[model samples]
Target: MLLKRLQPMMFQARRNYVELMFQVMGRALQAISDVDEPTREEVRALPEGFLFEMQVMPNGPKLIVEHTGDGKLHFHGDTAPRPVDLSIQFKHMAHAFLVLSFQEKTSVAFANDRMLVDGDVSYAVRMTRVLNRLESFILPKLVAQRAVKEYPADIHLPEKLMSSARIYLKVATQFVETVRA
Candidate 1:
């Protein structure tokens, strides 16, 4: 089965929701470099009152990240409704967020009912771009760091299963590459 190969890596995947959000936020902030200075400054200077409410689904926790207009980041949960400029929801874990940003197949994945996004369409589009940039630039570093921290040694797997898994990876990689090209 295709998932057999992925099973090994799955164990290595540490789905720390908090860390994932911070990684995305850090990368998104860095993506400001891709935009003009005034726009960047405006985003950076967003009011201290500005907040983003992220409602994670399927029993995951909800969080609010406060932007201090001065480019500082803070998070709170007990705050009242503060007229957020954007709110987003995703059913999958944050790793899927990174995957969606990297793969154009995400739209197809969503259409195929593998993922769901809800919120303002325009804001979501902009957010997608920001996430794309962040994923492109930041995920490699995060993955490497996480690999070392979470799994620093080789894992042994049954030889037959390992061979099958390698085949699956090859096919999946080719599919992704074809879709990308």
Candidate 2:
């Protein structure tokens, strides 16, 4: 009886958690692009005004990113944008929860057929690189080891610690600002 009652709430909680992560990911990408040259280079690989989305199927806790003409990626919250250049859609909210919660690495989830992506393969690859770079900057090495397929060996701990601090602060501030708005 309790299990049945809790199931819907659990699902909603996961959905909310995924939404929060999406917002954080969006901000982290923007913050990294400004401070990390390599991340900026990856963002530059997308053509001006290109848009890509990562979403959960049926309904959503979606996040869309458009490569602005100014050579940066802009996060469009959960609002759908027209003519998306690329899309990655998880088959279920559970799958989205698994990947977004860092319980499963994205590449592993994709390899396991948990999601479907529609768009240019090259752009997807570029986006993956961008995500990987951002993940390295935003996540702790321990969490990142699980979130990303391989934690970067070359990342200096002190540098990564500093970068993670900045990214977390940026995302937290952005969250506060969004709440205020």
Candidate 3:
């Protein structure tokens, strides 16, 4: 009796959590896409007009990114009216958040059958590199260490600090521009 009564509430709570994850991930991806030059370079391997999407199943949240150098992340309702070149879909909202929150690496999730991919293998590999670069920038070293297969050892404190500062400044500026627009 108690289980039945609690099921609906649990479902609602999970839905809310997934919605929040989508929003946060969309914004963070936008910020990273806007400022990270290396990530932009990595994305150059994609086709000239490619569209990539990261989406959660069961009608959960989604984010889209165009391959244009200046492309910013777009939430579901804002996606372009074109076919996607590649898509990475989480099996469910829980899996989406788990990967987004860095509790699970994207590659690991894919290996575990928690994710689905619709794209060319080489392009997907490049996209994974871009995501990994973004993760290195957005997450602290300690946390990122756990999320990535191998954090680069050559990035000493000085370079790391300088790049982090620049990334943060650019992300802040991008946020302001987005708000003003």
Candidate 4:
């Protein structure tokens, strides 16, 4: 499976690049939602104000955002000292992030066992709201662009299996669209 090849590379990378991107994007959303001048100032000050520990694993990473009374987003590795205020897990940090980027409802994915989250329910709820607000601001620009990259070489699959898989995929896609409609 492609996952077998990719999983090792993902772990070795260590930094969880995808998770870091989400943190930056999520913080931007929080900044946009700030109500008053003071809140806006607080949000502006957040780049260095909050502390977050990110851990990506077989089930994905957990993100703990700690906004100290002061203002700074202190990023920590998985083995940080403070207790986690929130945690989210997915098959990979990439999948967790794509769920947010694609504007898919995480609850549906979570219910289907595709994602898992724990710790302060209120914080999770607030995160969802923040994501919703962010989606409106980000999706339009994202969807308008095309993302295509050429592989070093074309991959070959067993002919019979490839044909069968194509047929199955087409049918499955149609079925999903029908159900959604």
Most accurate candidate by TM-score: 2
TM-score, candidate 4, is 0.45
lDDT of each: 0.45, 0.84, 0.70, 0.45
Model with the higher TM-score, candidate 2 or 3: 2
Better model by lDDT: candidate 3 vs candidate 4: 3
Residue 69, model 2: lDDT of 57
Model 3 stretches astray by more than 4 angstroms: 1-24, 27-34, 70-78, 178-181
The clash count for each model shown is 1, 0, 0, 8
Candidate 3 per-residue lDDT over residues 7-81, each given as its tens digit: 898777866776665555555555566665666667666666787777778567676767654444433433656
Model 4 lDDT per residue over 1-181, tens place: 9999998886556446565554454344333433213333443434333333334456344445555443323324234455565566676655555454454455555666766566655655544444443333333434412111111122223532343344345435544654698
Q: TM-scores across all candidates?
A: 0.42, 0.93, 0.77, 0.45
Q: Which stretches of candidate 1 lie over 4 Å from their true place?
A: 1-14, 17-50, 53-55, 61-85, 94-108, 139-181
**TM-score of predicted model 1?**
0.42
Query: Which scores better on TM-score, 3 or 4?
Result: 3
Off by over 4 Å in 2: none
Clashing pairs in 3: none
The TM-score of candidate 2 is 0.93
Q: TM-score: which is higher, 2 or 4?
A: 2
Locate the minimum summed-lDDT window of 10 residues in model 1: 147-156
Evaluated at residue 26, the lDDT of candidate 1 is 39
Ranking by TM-score: 2, 3, 4, 1
RMSD of each: 16.1, 1.4, 3.2, 17.6
